[model samples]
Target: MKTIFSSLFLAAGANAIITRWAPCCFHLSASGAVTGTVGQLDDGQNRVNGPLSPAEYCIADGAITDANGRGCILTPPTSQWQCDTGATPTSGFSVACDGTVAYNGGTTFYECQTGDNGEANIYLTPGGTNCGEITLKADGCGSCPPPPPPPPTTCPTNLNGNYEFPHLIIPIDSSNPNSAAGTSYFGEVSSTISSIFNFDIPASDSGKTCSLIFLFPLQSQLTTSSFTFSGNGAIDFSLLSGVATVSTSYANAPSVETDYGSITVAPGNSYNVATFACPAGEAVSFELKAVGDTCLNYFQDYNPSPIGVYITTC
Candidate 1:
């Protein structure tokens, strides 16, 4: 005989019943799914079936939402994943898990991380920032030259006077009739006449005396090496300007001698006047020599022998 079965009885005898059952809704209520048990069935025989599974799948559109309930999409499949943050790394530009970010060439910055062995975000300060765009280097410290040496001191000018002696002497030979041969003297006179003259004058006058001034003009600068004075002032004898007469008789012979001569003074470049004398007599000779300015003065004397003569004037 045919009989009706409740939902609970059918569920309990799910494997035993072979007859077709009417379709009913299996509602999933708030309390959850109901548990049932039946004998195990063969793998291919009494089982539910559905469409083949796909290698990749996605949920329905907008199925997963964030905390705000706004739908979010996953990134396309790739070997790596990346994020985009506004801040850049300290080092130069690089590819990382995050988006590309620029880095200052010389600046230093850091990020938050745990251990030590991680990517080092290092950079250098931007070149030429504080100092300005520097292409070449500026000069540095160096040494300078020392100051010049001081000038030299000068020497004091010398102020002194000069003088000379000019005279001639003749020797009487033994054979001369009018001369006492043994008493004749021919050597230089023994006196202090040869002593150097030392005197003083004004610096403006250059120690020059009157005679020198009267001879040369102020323009002529006289020096000890250039000029000197001569005469009795230089010695004991005063040089006289005039003619002289001499008459002599040999003490042991019979001949007599008479002589007349004239003396004259002329301008001298370096000294006072240079004197000249000439005596007149027959067979008599004379020699003239300068005796001043050591550079030009020298002793000279000459005589002609066998003279028996007289002179009216010289």
Candidate 2:
């Protein structure tokens, strides 16, 4: 054993070249675990690196007390290394990294950085630090808490506006008089139904009578489902294109517009708009039903009249 150690010392001093000066070998100290880069003497070779801690003689000091030691000195690893003390789950025990830089309670995974080409790797103790959970990359970020829940959903706003329907003919059913039904008699005034509001022409009838043109004042609203509407309409008792001219005072009411009709979603949900058409040879068909609140109110007063302009168009 003495001869072997002597040969180790001789080999380390061979680099000195001048005098037979060998560094003073470490006198085995009592401190069991000395910290810092105090080179380890192991595996049959004399070693020294950036002065792996030498209480007596550092390699920087030019000569050791006993020519370094009889073993290879481990230099801190060459590859860049990092530690990731994985996030400890909220309810579980802390999963930490060990003194060797490996993580606890998980697989030993070490990810390589952007091109770890031509580099040496050692995980034990890179840079003389037990960086647990080693990564070939410098960034040591690890698993994080789960992402926060998504924000709650919210209802969207609707567009409030008006819908205009131009030139629509609405026909009112003339047979259903409120109280007094109409009969064709020479003296008995025929049932006279009148829409006071004039649309461009006046039905100059001696008594208030019905006309063809209609004006629909509509309102629209949006709902959670889709869309809805409400409207009140008046048929113009003015110069209906083909109707006979009657010079009547009721047809001359300044504001002859009557709230006689409404537009609402029909029972089948398809009645979105109130429609009108003057089909050839057929009396203008206009759906002047007492549909909504306003329409029902107006029809109440304008009912059971002595004159029924028996036109099924509102």
Candidate 3:
């Protein structure tokens, strides 16, 4: 026998009862709580006192029924509608008692109040007819969904300003994840942070990256590891122009030195400006671009053809 169940918050009045019409002519094989109201399987099944009521609703299509019998509310095959696992198992739906079926073999309930109260024929309801349908379990009650997941956390970085390009930092935003980015301090990049520097150029990647920072023609620092470079120049605010001469050294060959002349050119297609966040006083977001011989060769690694940059820019 298949069955379904629903929870109803029930409070027994001084004199209250419940009823459900049998689906068809069916026998009431007394098993569970309905034995009292049912009286017997073949004899005294469908009969009620007070307002026919059954708080917790359940279904059990029995093997028998009765035609003229309005007394067959309590039919055979019983099952309990247990509550869902929670402090309260009644959330999304409502509970109702239905007994429209006359006698064939329908649903029923065991209204166990403080009274010697007994069984009653009643199926669980979403509410009105043709509303919804549910399946019943032979073992335990039915099922429902679990709770919901939590919200995501928020973390913002200070990066808001019009930053011109003197360098370009490119990180591989791809499946391989070979993107490169770092902080660049002016002059010889020392261990400690200095304010005399013009601005730091952060690459497209993160972590302690060392690059030459020249505030035009003064101040410098050199941190250990990787290829290191630093130099200085002068930018006349009045003229808005400057020349920067930079020297380079590497961890493999620290003593060797190479010079790279830096200047502002038209925004080349090869160079991509990237933004960085500064967690400090008045927040600052910078888009820095510095493309020179020191970085990767655009023609070989990225574009594959030098003509692309020339033609695209032209």
Candidate 4:
């Protein structure tokens, strides 16, 4: 037998009841033959006390049609309908029940209280159909965002900042470029070509603890594993500017060159050679000088550059 159920909520005097209606027309014969018609009511299953009077009525199609046939639905005026529990289910939404419906299905849902009890008998409706009415609201029920990720317990090794390529690379006077065309050669390739890197720090990372990282990839021959030409024992970091020519000697270097200190770099792929406190919103120049006389070069290929420097802040 085929069956359809209809539910309705009713309140009378000081009582509430769940009235369920099942069409009486759906019944199967002993031989398994389908019988009865749609909308037919079985009195035992459909009868319920009417909210209006003392008489009972049959529920059908979610409404009362007559007392014997079916009872008529009582439509109350504004402020006329009163809750038997003395308190309405917030009229629109219940915050305590907001996420309960979302656990079942749908991206959004509306929740409402069923009685003046604890957080029990919560009603859930999916989508925006019942919004702003007596039992649902447009803004009262919205899925809240998940809590943010927890902060890292330990300080990170690398900080976030803006880094740019150096505007100029000046080698010491009398030192010619290495076999690589535009690269600045350092150390005694023939006579000695000590290079100075002048990096332009962006003003965005100002007023923060900053550090400089130098990258030297082995594939680009930026670093020579051979100790003979890997003579970079220590590096000097300074704030330099007014570099008009590549032949500008360090002895007569610009007054803008404020030497930070000499720092040593370990033999590795990258080097965190210097750390400094960033100044105000001004483009500061970072100058680097290798101390030892080893034949090394800062590979200068813009396309997948091999050697570069990064300025980061924390």
Best by lDDT: 4
What's the lDDT for all of these models? 0.19, 0.23, 0.23, 0.36
lDDT of 3 by residue, 1-314 (tens): 22232333221322111222432221222233333222222232232222333222233232121232221122123322222211122211211122222212223333333232433332333222222233211211222334455422211111122222233122211222222223232212122211111233334323322222212111121122122333231111111012111221121111112222334322122221121232122211221223332221111111111210100000
lDDT of 1 by residue, 96-214 (tens): 11111112111122221112232111112222111111111001111223556643221111112322111222322233436432311122212211111111222333322222111
Model 4 clashing-pair count: 4
Predicted candidate 4 versus true structure: per-residue lDDT over 208-249, tens digit per residue: 666666655445353332223355546666666654245455
- The runs of at least 3 residues in candidate 4 whose Cα sits more than 4 Å from the true structure, single-residue gaps closed, are 1-161, 174-192, 220-229, 241-252, 255-260, 264-267, 301-306
Clashes of each: 4, 47, 56, 4
lDDT, candidate 2, 102-190, per-residue tens? 12222232222121221122222333232233321111112234567753221111111211111222222245333222221111111
Candidate 2: Cα lDDT at 151: 36
Which residue ranges in model 3 land beyond 4 Å of their true spot?
1-50, 53-149, 155-314
Give the higher-TM-score candidate: 1 or 2.
Answer: 2
Report lDDT (Cα) of residue 93, candidate 4.
13
| Predicted structure 1, TM vs. truth | 0.13
All candidates: CA RMSD in angstroms?
Answer: 50.3, 27.9, 20.2, 17.5
Tally clashing residue pairs in candidate 1: 4
lDDT comparing candidate 4 with the true structure: 0.36
| Per-residue lDDT of 251 in model 4 | 54
